[model samples]
Target: MTPERREEPGRRKALAFTVLVHAGLIAALFLGVQWKRSQPDVVEVELWSSRPTPAMQPAPPPPPPEPEVKPEPKPEPKVEPPPPATPEIAIKEDKKKPEPKKPEPKPEPKPEPKKPEPKPEPKKPEPKPEAKTQPAPDFSEMLKRESSERTARTNAASAQQLANAARAESELRAAADKKGMQDYAAKIRGKVRGNIVLPQSIQGNPEAVFEVIQLPSGEVLSVTLKRSSGNPGLDAAIERAILKSSPLPKPDNPALYQRTLEIRYRPFEE
Candidate 1:
């Protein structure tokens, strides 16, 4: 079947479903609007009376009008009569007659004069004991001396500490150099020993020592047979092996490099 014919049934189904949904929505809206229109309006009322209520009656007719008050009249003050006036009496002074005057007696003679009193002797003041005074101490000079001594002690302690630290550092450096030299020698010996080929004539375990001279780059300049293993073939084999290891292994620390090295090797010894 063609594509358009296949889609026609689905399209018709969708259209029918949409129509049903719209009709349902419309019916619901219509019912809601009708219900609102049919509902009756509610009324609110407040009950009241035209005349005053018992709780609101006029206030007891103003408490029956207070009684009127009247003031009483005061009595009049009484009057008193004055006492009768006393009569005036006059007093008279008496006059005396003059008598003859009498004469005063003559003055008596004065007594002899008294001798003058002697003046008291003057007193001598006592001398007070003297107090001995001590001289004041020189505090500034004492303080300066103490401060100088303290500073000297501090300087000496600092110097001692510095010397101790320097000595310890030197010892540590020497130990490290020694270890580096040993490691460098060991590596060279191992390389040379690996290249040695033993002869069948070799009877017992033999040891050979070779003195090698090298440059800073580890290039061998010369190899001298310092000691032999007693066997001629073994000695020759050890020399050839030393020559084969021309350029030796270098030290890890450059400061440990040496121009001459004494390497000892054994064929069967570990």
Candidate 2:
């Protein structure tokens, strides 16, 4: 019995060791499955699209297509129907001749009468009447007073002639001055017109006014636009033109020369 008991104890110990080993293996396998379930799964995928996003450096938007310029269509010429031909008609008329009248005779010239010779007159007797005044009226004094009166009349006539001559001279000078002023103004206008370069798109007679200052030598000192023509380009062009005409036309008469000029610029005919 002691021998059997010892064998039984050894078998039980072996079986117990085998059972503990199998239980440890089962515990390790369950922990590995739990760890695997807790861990996160990582997946990688690639995305593609036909169009590029802003984020992606989109190729510089194909250079914006250049705008095409079309030639302006030319206007067709108008055709007018010719007038119908007119038929010619001929007409004949007869002319009448008148008879001539007789001419009248001219009167004859009469002869002039001659003057008669003078006859001698009878001699008459002279009467001696010596009626001498107490004092011969002062004849010398009378002659002197008459001479003074004549001198005064001659002086007055001379004064009147001088006044008439002065008035005529003044009138002639004024007329000449006015003509000179007109001519000077015309010359200035012409000079400005010659230098002006009009814009192609301008329409209507839009006016641009300027106040200009100049030197006596016809040099343009300054040009200030007083009014605009509404078209900035046109106004700018004219302003440039005025400056380009640096030395303007000088007046024929220096007295007609002016320092300032108010010029009105018109695009069309002056």
Candidate 3:
């Protein structure tokens, strides 16, 4: 069958459904309209006139009260004290008060008198020609002495520089010797330190100084305590350590070895 014919049933069903829905909506609208109609409508109308209306008048005020009648106050009885008998003793006229004396005007001081002018003395005639002017002294010798002094100062400065150079050289040599001695002393210290054995009772940093006599072969011949530490045990321990460390390490240079060495031992110095 054709498409229109085949859709006829569906179209009819849709139309019928739409009609039923429209009818139901219309019925509901009609019922709502009837209900609104049933309820009475309120109409409000306001009329305006071009001319103004008259205002209301207020009531009038009450009348005033009648005048009051007051009785006159009785006159107070006169109780005058007998007028004091006119002060029988005569009143002397008031003594005239003395007028204050006006201060006298101060006299102006007179100006100081002018001093008399002094007469000038007459000048005496100039002295006649006398001795002739002295001749200027020569400065050549002074100049020569100054030159000599300058030359001497230069020479002295040169000599001082040479002396300073010599002293510097000596100081350098001494410093080198001191450094070598320090190294040798450090080596001996290390050796002795290794041999030292401190007691547990020893506390604080007690220092012991020893005068060590040694041979060039690095043998410690004698150990003499020069300064003893506060603790006798520490001092003894240091002496023993020095002796035990005989044949200590030798310096690189044999000449650096000293016959007597002052050694300061401190157990706390690590």
Model 2 agreement with the true structure over 85-186: per-residue lDDT tens digits: 000000000000000000010111111011111100100111111123325455644564466556555545554555555556555655565466567666
Candidate 1, poorest ten consecutive residues by summed lDDT: 86-95
Residue-level lDDT of model 1, residues 108-129, one tens digit each, is 1011011111111110110111
TM-score of 2: 0.44
Candidate 3 clashes between residue pairs 3 or more apart in a chain or in different chains = none
- lDDT, model 3: 0.48
Q: What residue runs in model 2 are displaced by over 4 Å at the alpha carbon?
A: 1-148
lDDT of each: 0.47, 0.48, 0.48
Give the range of the ten consecutive residues with the poorest summed lDDT in model 3: 88-97
lDDT per residue (tens digit) for residues 61-157 in model 3 = 1111101101211111112222111110001000000000101111111111111111111111111111121232335444544565565556556
What TM-score does structure 1 among the candidates reach? 0.44
Better-scoring candidate (lDDT), 1 or 2: 2
Badly placed stretches (over 4 Å) of model 1 are 1-144
